[model samples]
Target: MSDQKTGGFIATAITSIAHFLTEARKQPALSEEAGYGASPNLPKPKPTLIPIMKIAPAVGWPEGKKPTPAKGFAVEAFASKLDHPRWVYELPNGDILVAESNGPARPPANWSFRWWAQDFVMARAGAGRPSADRITLLRDADGDGIAEIKLPFLENLHSPFGMALVGDQLYVANADALVRFPYVDGTTRIDAAPVKVCDLPSGRNHHWTKSLVANKDGSKLYVGVGSNSNVAEYGMEEEVNRAAILEIDRVTGVSRLFAGGLRNPVGVDWNPVSGELWTTVNERDEIGDDLVPDYMTSVKDGAFYGWPYCYFGQIVDERVRPPRPDLVAKSIKPDYALGSHTASLGLCFADDGRLHERFRGGVFIGQHGSWNRNPPSGYRVIFIPFTDGKPSGPPEEVLGDFRSTEGKALGRPVGVIIDKKGGLLVVDDVGDIVWRMRAV
Candidate 1:
């Protein structure tokens, strides 16, 4: 952007700070109790012009410290001192790729007051850094928890987040589009120019990260695209082909919307037993802290889960003008609630069962945590039990204590995946650490 835009954002940031101080918003009416399991109790919608602002400032962890894992498990820094490590992917050859990135500057977003406020919040949360625009490879050649080899795998990219390998080709999901490059087994670095797969919605990218997953046969790709605005406050036209997952044809490079109204779907994974696609979605905010619950659910093709119009089934959000009852009626309820503003992002299935038996055959969720709710939620990794391919019970905290006693954020969990040794790898964006969890 321009200097004028930057000045305007600064002004808006000041106004947001003043508004937050002046407005004593309503506290959470219900605990996270109403938000969890297969069927959560949806409370009444509490709309507001000013959202509750409670940001946990990001503070780097002290030396020789790490996250606290649950019982029967151990946690250690798999990789550390990286620049904004956001997402991780494990290759078949036991190599791990970490996408060290941040959002790109969008000129259109700089003009909006909402964008200014959000930009201020992200800066406080240590997410306002310039994009590193690269992926680094980490190798635990000795089977130790720590990576023994670190190499610059792929560099000079645009806000890349997700990766998928199909045979000799590797696909990358950037903020604005999808691209592919040829891959060779055991190759440490890729310097080749990528083939442009397709152009994704690249507007004032409020939600920048695009997650990718390939079908079993590697013939198709599933990419998660998030909403352009909080709840279409910038008009519905700006949200076209967003807040959903898209299916891309591998050969033709053509893409189509697979699911809609997901708000901010982040992590995409395939269920081992059910053979179905599942995603963790961050629900809409600005309503009461307890209104709309973030969720994880098995996705169906062409299904709408309600964005600006409704949520958690037919609960309507009155703020959206010219309501679409037709779409709301068709909106499908989610499978499980992850609590409002939890920022649940990373998702992976525990198909290998390397952890304790209690964690076997469940979903591991990396919650990046929240800033909009008082007594903030979601700063660690959680496990949700799944029986017969569906959510069976409430989530259990697998790793936690991301916040200090004074509420300073020590770390936040992001992308999660099982490494070659069946160890769980979690990306800590703010702390610049990748934590490895294994059975003790």
Candidate 2:
């Protein structure tokens, strides 16, 4: 799977074409600050012939070098050298489960320019590694902020991403379905087979990562399913139950659509202050540098945020044939824009006094960084303050330098969570490390 030499020549040629296209493109109409906040500046449309393809090849971190931690905090590697670690879940007993996974091989329906370009880009961005298909358990028995033991907790998963423990059953959101297994507190391994809860959308599987979360009472489950193709290019029939959030009953496994038109809501959590569900969504691309911005919003039940037709609420995308003006009229504007093409994929709000008091009432997000925009954005961890369940202050960079000085991706932060010891843990999928940051 790590075969760079195979498409090296074609990829090199494509890079040259990309540079020309970027230069021909107009500069961003909105300023950097306009790309964020609740009322972000949405620029005019200037769709490109092909998606803007640019990337900093993923190169493992150099020995002894790591990300720069925010002031008043110290950072350390919780676990290192993992194979494509993508997401994390902390058990009630303080055990951390990291999903070591990569997308399963999926060829395009018919090979074309877009397909080849995406394939080359994904491989160079540290996705060339095959899925490890297992969740490893890390334990900090001594509480030194470093995991003392790293063991295979569960094996043979199908690209598992989100995990949660509710009572005696552990729910794992594999790409294809929701499954459960028997669990014992403080155990290191599970040999028991999983019971399928329900199937998830996976055909074509353009966006295969299915993020999962449970309710406060643990009586219900929410799974975020992404669109199978960009803008429903493959056909709307393939997009059934996609680009929407599915709510499932833990008892009967019956699922229903919670919200729709989110594009790709990779993370979901409940707002402790407002008692509302929220999600971070990745917006549609290939439009322009500032036309669409990825955002986070309070997910209202039976709501449609508008995908493949509109973005940032009421702004219609003309590319979609057979216009849906009715849907555009009802599109809900997001609560906050995370910057265009920032690829904001992970979200977790601070509910308790877990971390430092300065960061007590805010949300920690992991922006996986962007390849669709030049001068790449969001390769770090950021904290946005909130009050009364709404964002109140500007964002602060919590961790940075995810890419090397030579324009190589040293890491790409994916999932962010608060550990049992009141510390922040970030999953760096590209660097293959889980970084822990605690107050000094």
Candidate 3:
């Protein structure tokens, strides 16, 4: 089939699936006794409609701007021995919680001579063992600037990604659902059982989950559901394949799709100044280095970003071909393109209120190193400047030199968070450390 025809078919299939799911959930089943006896009664649910909005194309950065170095950011290694730390949340008492994504290894029993030989041979065979996944709370008990480790907050999570603190509650985004626990101040252990807030589709592996954010008032929660496959061309079901952003009511567990056509939005945050939702999306790869551009965009309600059939601020997807001619006029492009394959992971707005005047109202995103390109790109943090709630310039490297001169990386950053004291904490999953950046 032609690219245009394929795009149309995919779009139609996705819409039909979404509609069916929505309608099926709304319908009520008939009770046999009520049907045979008195008047049947059933409450009708409200119809939900997904919104689609148009966004303007992004402008590129000005000429002759050099990338900034990490030294200028005054990065200091704060804590170590973190295995795949995914997200960091700061508490009111100057303590921080770090979520590790790996699973625990089984302890070996007493060794016999034959068992020792077998273990040694197996170790040499290089079998991959599961690592521990736990949440650790760090704080400085003394006046020293360094943070000391506390007891594990929770253990045996299935790849927890993002966390949020609302009042006395701590909500964590686990692989298949949102789990919550009562977070008492100055306590290392959560004595209560975790309550399930929302269940999400997970474990397809192609797109792992990340980044859960709540509105300022904690009324709504947003979760990122990544696409099941790259470009959705593998003929996966629409309910499982299409990339989407989900919004749920905090009081109720009811959730609905907030936006569609976003492939894998790794980092999502609400702009401190504008209160607008912004996301850093990892675009589809393997078509060429620059065919589709990864982006940091202001997500809109019901926005149709051309995924599978369009990309990078309205460039018709050549692989999908012919393109959706109807969508060509309506498809909203990204707000700012952060080069192709930058692998943007974590996003946080600079609310220090003390950054360089030009740095205020901007965002800091951790690019988690890339693998598709020749020279290898994105092993550093970048800045996206905004003015009056819109991006003013292209993404500029604010933290650099994480990658070696030959482009090999010594560390990979996964999530960025601002601590209680207004310092920035970046999680380096590859280096197994968390680095803190503070103003000198």
Candidate 3 structure, TM-score to reference: 0.74
For 1-440, candidate 2 gives per-residue lDDT tens digits of 35577567777777888888877756544554458889976768878887777688898799999999998889999999898999999998999999998876775464666667777789888898789999999999999999989999999999899898999999999999999999999999999999999998896777889899999899999999999777878778888899999999998999999999999999788898998999999988888777588999999999999997888888888888878999999999999999988889889988887788777668988999888677678888989999988999777889999988888899999999998799999999988999999888
User: What lDDT does candidate 2 reach at residue 174?
Assistant: 90
* Consecutive 10-residue window with the lowest summed lDDT within model 2: 25-34
Flag regions of model 2 displaced more than 4 Å: 1-9, 24-34, 107-111
Name the runs in model 3 displaced over 4 angstroms.
1-72, 102-131, 142-145, 236-242, 321-329, 354-358
CA shift of 5, model 3, Å: 42
- Residue by residue across 67-180, what tens digits does model 3's lDDT show? 234445566666776655667877778778888774223235433333333233222222122434577888867734467765688886667777888888888877678888
Q: Candidate 2 at residue 299, lDDT?
A: 96
- Model 1 C-alpha lDDT per residue in residues 1-440, reported as the tens digit of each score: 99889877876666577456536545535664457776777667766666567788899798877889998889999998889999999988999999999999868636766776788789879898999999999998888789989889999999999899999999999998899989999999999998999988877998999999999999999999999988898899999889999999998999999999999999999999999999999998877777678899889998999997998887888888989999999999998889888899999998756666666679999999988776588998999898888888888898999988888899999999987687899999999999999987
Q: Write down the lDDT of every candidate, Cα atoms only.
A: 0.88, 0.88, 0.64
Candidate 1: worst-modelled 10 consecutive residues by lDDT: 20-29
The list of candidate 1 runs beyond 4 A from truth reads: 1-29, 108-110
Q: For model 3, what is the error of residue 225's alpha carbon versus the real structure, in angstroms, after optimal superposition?
A: 1.4
Candidate 2 residue pairs that clash: none
RMSD of 1: 2.5
